[model samples]
Target: MAKMRDRRVAPSSERRKNPFAAATATRADKTGDSASDRKLVTSFVLLCIVVIPAVSVLLYYVKNAPRASHTISLAHQRGLIKTDVTYQEILTVISENASQLHRHYTYPVLAYITPWNSKGYEMAKRFNTKFTHLSPVWYDLKSQGTSLVLEGRHNADMGWISELRMTGESLVLPRVVLEAFPRELLRNKKLRDKAIDLILTECKEMEYDGIVLESWSRWAAYGILHDPDMRKMALEFIKQLGYALHSVTSVRNNKQHLQLVYVIGPPYSEKLQVHDFGPQDLQSVGDAVDGFSLMTYDFSGPNNPGPNAPLQWIRLTLQLLLGSPSSRVQSVGWKIFVGINFYGNDFILSEGEGEGRAITGREYLNLLEKHRPEFQWEKNSGEHFFLYSDDNHAKHAVFYPSLMSVSMRLEEARSWGTGISIWEIGQGLDYFFDLL
Candidate 1:
């Protein structure tokens, strides 16, 4: 009895010492105010959750708010317009753009390729899809008949020098490659021979869809445009070029026809108009070659904000081409590729600086279709008519289209039996392959 009492006394003493020895009997309610504490803990956790994310998003929006809503690449940024294009990849893009075009026009467009700054051949080799490329092998405007490549300063942003068509002096080039050609090579007879050798070698190895002589207007026009001797020499060179292309195509036993294309112009002294070029100018160029590629852009005065070679002017020119006795030659020869803008028509300025839209080719569609839904192209006014504010901005883009607009460009192409060439290769015209 004494031992049992001692054991019980020991257990009780241990319990008292531990202060929490009633473990089996004790519960959460005994230890604390359970309901109120739980409520307080839940409220604290919920407040933490609500405040943290709201603060994060608020900070993010604040940081991005200062950025201009519509700024693309900044002005100082290089507008090189390059892609890390593989040969196969670029061909794919060509096929893609071609296919999208097919949906709009049942007749697949005669996809005419334009030469890139220095990347022509590399671009040509990528595709087996046969199209047109305007080769630089023909008489270069810079060196005239003396050299294949142009050698002069790149054209000013205004493109004013070509407007002037310097009489006795050298004209400036609008590309770095031509501007940087070796002077010694051009001056020395032996070097000139070697230069021709190098150029022909590359051009022969990789054939273009066609060849375009630089400023054919300057070269083809006798006396009125340039010295008769220079004009005669240039024409002789063009004849040789035409014959040579005929031989190469003949040798391949590929009856692939060549289009000898050229960019023509009226001098800077004269006002630029479609009527500026008459039947005689077209006739002279047609006699030299297969087609006329009107660089139908840059017709506007220097720094004009109007559309680059507006459709009004374009329609006038096209109508002339379509109507002329040169129309026979014009039908096949009329390769009218209206130059689309990679840059703006001119700057929208802020205090004499370009503080305007860096409108891209795709963005033009927005003006015609999205921004001003009701705008139409007026023929008599010879421009896209729209309402504008006194602030000198094009407020509503109302475009004019009779038969000459994009609405009928390809349709008319089919009707008139001519080619419609755009000044580019890549865009999002891939539905043809994808629909498969």
Candidate 2:
């Protein structure tokens, strides 16, 4: 401490010229730059891996979520939700209860709409949401010499097509009873193939969802039912048509296979002499087609004085279809749709067989509203009737099904996990829509 050490200071020119010192300072600067570059690259990687996906998820949810006001308004319009509450309150309620009622119902509700019926378009618009399939009873086939041809022209109006499509429903081509029975066509393979080809071509051109084959042939006739040859021909024709139809993809729905529905009369009882369909035929046809629409109604018309479709008869008919353990019903219960009549049969008190008339559901409801007659609901039969004197001064008994009857039928269908279809639309009262 007492001795003073020699203080040596390097010249400024020497310090600037020292390459080692310069190299050391440059290494420190490069090390700091490398650390900053690593930090920037890490941040960029995290943004791509985490932040991008988070933003995408947020955008997807926003786009797909239903708007509260629109959903609430639609519910109110459908009479599903009451309008007594305030808009804000309804929004909250709808948000909370949306999952309970929003598209909750399963099973298809197919409605037959005839072009001749003036109310067809209006009814389609009014009840489009309720119907899963809208079938126009428009087309048929007829024998043209040795070949079969489309009989009636399809509806030219394309307006209904777009309107129905907008509702997320399908328009199926309905082939009613051709002038000549289909069995006759089936007898000739050449004619059957030609007919099926034409039908498939038309379906592809018109972009139909599928075809419906209605029961009109006497194949189910007592004489023909005993003929094994005729039954074999009929089954073969169905199988071929089904195969051809399914092979072609639908233009309307590319992902879905074409549907083939067979509409047949109710299964006959063992003792019933006037049976149209046998159990064997039912099983064979059921296996070939995508679904079976059982025409359980029309038990009585103007010709007979009875309920359109008595509950007891319906139950028996269902039993006949579903009774056999080896039958198609057990395996394909969901494919079977029980047909409901939206019309009624009116018989005059003095009329004999075939003396009464068939009236639409709207006509019957109108009578009830205008006359205000003593309405009677037969609980046991699940039918509604009223006694009134017509303009002819003759007593008349009108039998029809009310909403109550329809509800009972729906419950029956649900128990079996089966579907329900209406014979025709644009015939029912407003309240009937509420039940659906």
Query: What's the TM-score of each model vs. the native?
Result: 0.45, 0.72
Cα lDDT tens digits, model 1, 116-212, are 2222222222321322332222223234344454332131222222222222111111111222133333335554454334434433443333444
RMSD of 1: 31.2
- Report clash pairs, candidate 1: 96-429, 155-174, 163-268, 375-398, 376-399, 376-400, 377-399, 377-400, 378-400
lDDT of 2 at 417: 58
lDDT of 2 by residue, 143-209 (tens): 7777778765546356777777776565565644434455568677788888788778878877888
The model with the greatest TM-score is: 2
Best by lDDT: 2
Tell me the lDDT of model 1 at 401. Answer: 19
